[model samples]
Target: MTPSRPATAPGVREPAGTVTGPVGRLSPTDRFLPLWIVAAMVLGLLLGRAVPGLDEVLSAIEVGGISVPIALGLLIMMYPVLAKVRYDRLGTVAGDRRLLVSSLVLNWLIGPAVMFALAWLLLPDLPEYRTGLIIVGLARCIAMVIIWNDLARGDREAAAVLVALNSLFQVVAFGLLGWFYLEVLPGLLGLERAGADFSTGRIVLNVLVFLGVPLLAGYLTRRTGEKARGRDWYETRFLPRVGPLALYGLLFTIVLLFALQGGKITSQPADVARIAVPLLAYFALMWAGSYALGRAVGLPYDRTATLAFTAAGNNFELAIAVAIGTFGVTSGQALAGVVGPLIEVPVLVALVYVSLWLRRRMTTEGSGRGG
Candidate 1:
């Protein structure tokens, strides 16, 4: 059974991929997301430009190759959303072979290939930016897919299952896939690979610290919370309080990232514009293709929404961490990774409206199941 949607909280800004209310009742954070993102980007750039030597201070402190402040922001951004996941509900989703298999193919196989192709086609000459986009593709949606699913009234249980699966897979497959896409596939295609000498051990370690620690904490928190006070309290009462932290963490991270690289971004507007092209195509194609696939297979709208969203969204947090850890903080790769969410947040938010409209049309046509 799916977890019940949280009751609407007045003025409470749910995290990007975590909590959402019905469409008409979207929080200010949700509705004006593009504005907020643009604001965050602007603020960050301003901070860097205004304060001399600030970027140096921000980058000076580091833990595990990432700036300490940026790393903390990433952790804060991820934990609340991961905590909200109903990890126990995965069993319910596992039995749905069609949905599971479909998600697997869409997320792991076709999704990466599509991004790889787009990055090469659009930014063939810009290797650093291109590699960043490739990292974005390899990192599938463990975040924000749920928010899209919830907003679209998708299958919550399936969404949770898919997210959990992505999380687990990332710990293992991320390094391997990095090896393949960054090195092996390029060699086979006679394409010059990314110039950085990526150490797999380092990637894995970063994944463990960035994703693994938070995941374990989220799981333990849920378990302890439920056992002590039960699921209802854990979901409704506790979640609302901690959930807002996700946005705080996300915005904080963005600010720090921009503060460090603001000068580069402002100076090279054309390069940033170049990076945006492939990401725009990636999101649109993945969402549309997966949605069409779902309908072709005769799945209901809810699960189809889940599949489409899960397939379309990338884990920008992880991508950014990997980029920063592998490349330096100010590298073009990290900047490309940062640009990912700037595009994804607004695009997927718009898609939620599209999904709702399509749902209405399907109902009017009597194509809805059990209608």
Candidate 2:
């Protein structure tokens, strides 16, 4: 295991990670996530196109207005991520007020606005798709981002705090933000409004189902595991065993989504590209903007990387759930949400490399300035 760093102190220049030595190397699974996701996409599309009956069977298993297969996949994907969060460290992050406030503002305010603008600019004619993109933007990330931040050797404690903060905020803000951006704002912009229903009850329920259950499970698991096996054993043994389950669940979920929506994707290949434009742009723009802002504010490299990633990543699970719940299983909105992870996994992995390069460059510059 890579040695864990101490919790960040306010305005302190702690070592982010080894600058000259090999940092944390990727596990085989981490190295191939994008490839696995692509394979799952291909298999799902093939299953949907060839075995059309499968969709009906999976779609038939509904519970609480959510598809059973989807619900299970989501639970599996989310639980491991939440389980890893160090909720106890949230209070420690408060001392670094700059990092905390900057991350929150970028994620909730600037990130959503940028996505909304890009969706309108890129897909003016496709309201459902636009609304789907907006949903992606509003639901800030809490899960996979930990993997990205870890890969980049960022401030793990800060990442944990931000993830916990974002998860709680999404439960309260996502529905209202969805209504405001997808419905009211579009109407005010004189654009065709999305027809999907944005019910606060449904949104809250989905949050409870998707995030709340997993969070509680994670908390319980941590408490029990630590009590029985000690913190080091739990972190090294128990977490390692369970952490990759989330990725497995994510790949499985992708396959199901693609299988269900294969017909639409095949029929309208151009639409996939169209939906992708705003999403790709959103990731690039938000990452660049957040990185620059963090540098301008004189944050250290690790915190800056954390802020950039936290702002750039989206909780696609929540977005997909809301899209499917609001629209139907095969709605264009849901398709947009499904495409989010497909796009995100590859894009973020690449950005992990970019962040490392940035970190090295920034550190060298700082050294030169001191000299």
Lowest-lDDT window of 10 residues in candidate 2?
18-27
lDDT computed for candidate 2: 0.81
Candidate 1 positional error at 225, Å: 0.7
Candidate 1, residues 191-305, lDDT tens digits: the string is: 9888766676777787888789888999999999999999999987998788778778878877877888887888888998999899989999999999999998888999999
**Per-model lDDT:** 0.84, 0.81
- RMSD per candidate (Å) reads 4.6, 5.0
**Candidate 2 root-mean-square deviation in Å:** 5.0
Candidate 1: where are CA atoms >4 Å away?
1-23, 367-371
Which ranges in model 2 have alpha carbons more than 4 Å from their true place? 1-24, 196-198
lDDT (Cα, tens digit) per residue for candidate 2, span 177-296: 877886788789787777646565676677777777888898889888888998899888888888888887888888888888887788889998899889999999998899899889
Worst 10 residues of 1 by lDDT: 1-10
